[model samples]
Target: MAEEQPFALQRHEKLMERLRLHGAVRVRELADALGVSELTIRRDIAALADRGLLTRVHGGATLPTVLDETPARRRRASAPAFTIGMVVPSLDFYWPQVVNGARSAAAAHGVHIQLRGSSYDQAEDRRQILRLVESGQVQGLLLAPSLEGPGVAELIDWIGGLSVPAVFVEREPPRWTPTPRPLEWVRSDHALGLELAVRHLHAFGHRRIGLVLSKGSPTSAHLAAGWHRACEELDLPDDFVVRESVALNVPGHREIIGGIVDRCRRDRITALVVHSDPDAISVAQYLTEQGASIPDDMALVSYDDEVAHLAHPALTAVRPPKTTVGRTAVDMMMARLLEGRNRPVQRTLVLPELVIRASSITSSWQRETPPAG
Candidate 1:
């Protein structure tokens, strides 16, 4: 006879289908349907909850509420008594985790989050902000910007005029330009995290290290500065620094990795540090296809840790304290909402940790040599 399916997988499949069909399901009912104890069902639900897949209620679970897509003007005009707005470039993997943290914190304070995405378009970002502010829908904002091109200056100008209290997340305002008076920010220390990645490679005896950047953005600038700091600290020559910028898409990533490898070949770079896990995995695949073995011919490291472990050769990455950033951003926003908008401005900076994995190791060429007799 065939063996019974694993309890975890069985429960996950049933939970997903139930959530899709019924929008929510109680723990006891789910357990009875799957022929498992309620305790078993609770564990299954907890696993999903950890990933922000479903919301756990007192006795069961429910689907996350879909964000209202009403026009910003309309939303602002009929804004709730206490509503917070989250302005992000797009609702991708990164933003969602931050949003989850914000939502959880907001729920505790009896507040709601009005999340808006800009599709990485600066104009749209301005429009969304204006709608929220003019309609008076949001009392505060948690902004994670995508200041990619010429429009950033304009976007910043608009945000400065919004009057409501705001906190910038993920990316900080530019250095040369003075931000509109009294703008506050909460961000991961990209410089510190990237420095950690580079130092990890250097400790493994990799002198020639390459970097992949997302060009034309302030975020990339911080990452580049960190890479340079590491190289400078180690006294590596300028030629050892190979930088390549690519768009944030599958095709763009493919092209960027190809460019990185090309730079590696010309410069004899034996290691690479990327800005994100997705890019690290892409570069690893490209290197493997080109007959280079990981931790043998080259070493690799990256910034974000979420996708690292899932790669073929688990990646060594600098894990940002994303949950903390989320929690902090929400806390700041809530303070603005509760304590009146005139409260003293605050800034929170979160440091990330380095996680070592199989993808990065001492370069084979750097392995210890036997002592002579």
Candidate 2:
């Protein structure tokens, strides 16, 4: 037997369908058609109004005129009139949120996002960006650059010469090198996020902290800076910080965690902080498999709070204000398009906050017990 739909959802669905077909609908008519009371229809209208899906009129409801097109149409028209190329290192879990934020922000201003993944490979990324620029189809670009790419300076020069605005996300260009033209950029304050995570761990009495990072990215650089800053503020020695870089893949992650565990055993590290939630979860799970007790033998903290909830022991993570970063990027792009090119270069750095959870706690074990000779 088929399950019946809930009354509220059914009412909302019917009302939306009616509005879509007829462009507007009266409460009484909607109630009669859906076999619900007029009062029920009014409630439904109010709910939709609260969601900004529709506007409530004197006796009826109307479609939201602000919506440029139906959801279906919007997905199909992902790349609208002006193509905005989005270049990222990979389409991992975190990238999706950043991309979603960009897409939503672009939609508000009637722009579109055409996405391309680089898989952290510099050569392929440069080729893709050059192709898009040479094609003359893309008006602007939102790039997340790899830190260790070859010929990066040459590529940046090429991009600058394209005569289109570019916004770097999650990474910043080198400060030492001057660009022929100024570039607008937007990024999450990873340093701030790491500081928050480290502070939380320190508050829980974790002194010997280890960081797991991915190498060759500006994001990693900022995180490293924050980790160093926290250690300085806490009056801890540089030796208290241990770091290992790994590629961002399944097998790579396994090897990295194995290395981290080995380091923990050798260094007597009590607390660990990872750069991403997925990595933290993986490390925790791997530690459990090895018969190590969490929050007792070791404490864990990480960044990107979404996947934290899904971990076996919900992870303590730093949540970046990604939505704000997205919206700000759009605002910057709009200003570039509408205003003259000679305006001052704009940069927006969104701050992140630490969300404490079960994964990290006060360290119970004071020292690693050694085997008797």
Candidate 3:
């Protein structure tokens, strides 16, 4: 049998499912259904409410009436002052949160978002962007393009020539060249997120921390920079840095992870900071299989918060402020479209938060140990 999930996470999953099936959930009913106390149910409702995931009524929670519309359906709403075309690398995982935030912000500001999903390939990015541009159905663009591809310079040049206003989401332009016009951007401070993860492990009495980056992600460079800087500032050992990212989906991932684990063991590294949650979870599984104790022998922190809470032992993770990045991109687009040349180039960097969990602490330690009796 599978191990039971943590109370908070279990409740959250059930609560979301209940809401989906019943359209709303009553606190007392949910408590009785889940075999938990009414107070616990109430707390869950309040937490979900605070996150804007649900609407809390006097005695129950209901879905947000108009705001809960699907992305495609939402786009069909009555034409507004502006229609913004958005293209992101992936619709799954991290990009969804950013899209939701953008949609919410657009709704609030009486704008419409025409979204398109693209793959990691630069050609796909260009194709999707060109489709949006050719459609001529949108007045502005919000893009999270693949910046590392060989065609990056050409892509930049094309975007520079677009007639409509454009704002990059979770991406920044190269600083080496002056473009025809100023570019606007809104991105999460991924570097700070990495720093936060390193600092968190350090606080747990880990001196030598290893870093495993995802070579495929643009965020890896920023994360590596932060990892090095934090080690220097905190006076911690930094020789265990892995310059290459371990791709979790590849066929030889297991062997690669085994090598990484062996390196950690040889270096006596007590903790690790991984680029994304999936990679971190893979490392955890490998460690468990190798007879190493999590948190006791090795503490772990994942960079992205997407599914870290679902990991065995529930990983501590750095959550990028995705929603804010999306919302801010829309806000910047609005300013640029409305103010025209009067508005200066807008650049915003939102901070990420560290979500602490059982994985970050030593398994042998208690949260509140009793004094000598």
TM-score per candidate, in order?
Answer: 0.69, 0.69, 0.76
User: Could you tell me the C-alpha RMSD of candidate 1 in Å?
Assistant: 16.5
Query: Which residue runs does candidate 2 get wrong by more than 4 Å?
Result: 1-81, 215-218, 240-259, 363-373
Give the lDDT ranking, best first: 3, 2, 1
Best by lDDT: 3
Separate clash counts for every candidate: 1, 0, 0
Best by TM-score: 3
Candidate 3: minimum summed lDDT over ten consecutive residues — where?
Answer: 69-78
TM-score of 2: 0.69
Instruction: State the weakest 10-residue window (summed lDDT) of model 1.
Output: 68-77
lDDT of each: 0.72, 0.73, 0.82
Q: Model 3 over residues 6-86: C-alpha lDDT tens digits? A: 456557767877686689889888888999898988877765554455787888888666665332233333347568999
TM-score, candidate number 3: 0.76
Error of 2 at 11 (Å): 49
Model 1 C-alpha lDDT versus the unseen true structure: 0.72
lDDT of 1 at 140: 82
